[model samples]
Target: MKKTPSIIAAALVLGAAPAFAGSATPAAPEPVIEQAAPVPFSSPDWTGFYGGAQLGYANIDTSAGGDDDGFIGGLTAGYDFDLGQWVVGGGLDYDFADISIAGGAADLESVFRAKLRGGYKIGNGLLYATGGYALADTNTLGSDDGYFIGAGYEYLINQSFSVGGEVLYHEFDNYNSSGVDVDATTVQVRGTFRF
Candidate 1:
């Protein structure tokens, strides 16, 4: 009778092994995460040094009763500082021309300018106003000091190249000691390479 009880107890423990394992709690599964994508395009940086050229027409009128128009072309260089929504710069320009006065009185030969510019930033460009001092040269009338004011717009084709246009009004009270007033209007197309 003692041997029978011992055998029965061992059989009961073996049979309960699978049930005990199943009754215990199972662990939770881990989570899966996804990441977001990045943007593709951005705005341009306008602060730099630049050199360029321009070509256009000039209409000249004089107090001596002469009026005429002809070609004007020039090279320019400048440095610009970008200030958040604004940009400012200073530059120089030298233009060559040979527009005649009506009745062959004189030929306007060339002009040199020292310029200051400031503008509002618009997309990939600037809408700006410019003014400066200028020296006007003529074949017969000699050279004279003058002032000019203008407005322009510049657009970037890329980071390194830009194109623009301007309209300026220039005035001189005396033409090289001749006591004749001169006024000029100029329109130009400009191209630039930036560094």
Candidate 2:
């Protein structure tokens, strides 16, 4: 009878062993796996202010039978606003020249301009059209008000620098009140500093 009781006790202990094993802290939960989050997409930014210099050639034609050509150079400053694929801006420039009239009657001295430009952006390059008011000065005849229109292309070298070129046509009627109509075409290579 004692052997029977001991056997019964052993069986009960064995049965309780499985129950204790099940109740033990669950095996550490399976390692969790997570995916990395996606990155955001964006476009290039090009809104700012700028300033620069230019050097190029000027060819002049006069209604009074005189024509001439020479070198011109100047300073420029501007501001721009970026609009997705397009940009618009305003600029001002002043150029000094020493071009003489073909007939030795006078010399063209300087030019000043206030301009507006609109451009299309394509892979770091800007193709634009510009037009505005101009003032032409002469060494002898005086200075006169004029207008100019032109096209240009500028490439961004970085966040603070750019290079470009422009070709403009200008008209000064009855130049400096001397009863001479003057037409000038200027081609310039430009370098700019942006802020």
Candidate 3:
């Protein structure tokens, strides 16, 4: 009976040892995989108020009978609205220049102009048209003032920046001591920055 008990005890210990060893071994640490984060999906918005300056050339054809061309510089301010692929806006601008009629013999006059513009955005560029009024100081010849119209296109080089070119026409009725009526045309290349 003692031998039988020893055999039973030995068999029990051998069977239990394998189970205990297996439990202690720690189950191969379940595969520790990790997932990556998702990226954001959205575009930037562009609608606001902007202001800038412009420098350009102006050519005037006088109906009273003289022609003049010179450089012009000015400041501009406006508000913009972005609607899908198109953007619309209105702006006011002013420019000053020293211009003369006839020849270098004639005295220099200061010319001033104010304008309003409307534009449509096409791709990275904008197509625009503008109209306004102009005023200038004439020698004893008198002063000239009139309405003007223009059209231009601008390409956006980056956010808050653009460059453009335009052509404009102006008409002055019965201007100055010369008693001559004048019509003028101007073309200019301009650049602007937005805020």
Candidate 4:
């Protein structure tokens, strides 16, 4: 009977000991965490090329006599150097137009021109200037030849296209067979393509 009592006590002690032992503290609530996605890598860059056409109005003011205005059209080809905020390049341009002087009565035939240019880019726009030689048909009184200097600004619409405006001054010797030196100024708006 004493043995039975001792065994029962031992059983009770073992049960109570298991109850006093702590439960596993619930594993710290699984850390409640979120993770972000990895970012993608980008490729290295290279310089590109472009080309386009231009159409604009030209106004010519002659020192000897009068003023003339007409439509001009041409093509442009250029290269961009990818020089950070600025692009440097050379280009060729030509245009043809019919002009009149003195009360729209005295007419000059087609005036043809070609020029070489260099420019720098500012944001989406470009600030530039050019100087070149020019050839033209006969004036109302006679024929002439000269050099021109001009400044302009252009706004780029995309990687391949832009439009702008310019003003140029021209000086001719022996203008119109009069042995007189003459000066002319022109203002024009133009478009261009980059290549």
C-alpha TM-scores of all predictions: 0.79, 0.78, 0.64, 0.59
- Model 3 regions more than 4 Å off: 1-46, 83-86, 102-108, 139-142, 176-178
Quote the positional error of residue 85 for candidate 3 in Å: 4.6
Clashing pairs in 1: none
TM-score of 1: 0.79
Query: For candidate 3, what is the TM-score?
Result: 0.64
Return the clash pairs for model 4, or none: 49-195, 50-194, 50-195
- Among all windows of 10 consecutive residues in model 3, the one with the lowest summed lDDT is 102-111
Quantify all predictions' global Cα lDDT against the true fold: 0.91, 0.91, 0.70, 0.62
lDDT of each residue in 70-177, candidate 2, tens digit only: 999999999999998999999999999999973778898999999999999878889999999999988788899999999999999887889999999999999877
Name the lDDT of candidate 4.
0.62
Candidate rank order under TM-score: 1, 2, 3, 4
Worst 10 residues of 1 by lDDT: 34-43
State which candidate, 2 or 3, has the greater lDDT. 2
Query: For model 4, how does the per-residue alpha-carbon lDDT over 59-136 read when each residue is reduced to its tens digit?
Result: 665545666777755555555455655545555555556666544644445444556556666666767777777655
Segments in model 2 whose C-alpha atoms lie over 4 Å from true places: 1-43
Q: For every candidate structure, what is the RMSD over all alpha carbons to the true structure, in angstroms?
A: 6.8, 6.4, 6.8, 7.1
lDDT per residue for candidate 1 within 32-61, as digits (tens), equals: 776767775555778999999999999999
Total backbone collisions for each predicted model: 0, 0, 1, 3
The clash tally of candidate 1 reads 0
Q: In terms of TM-score, which candidate is stronger, 3 or 4?
A: 3
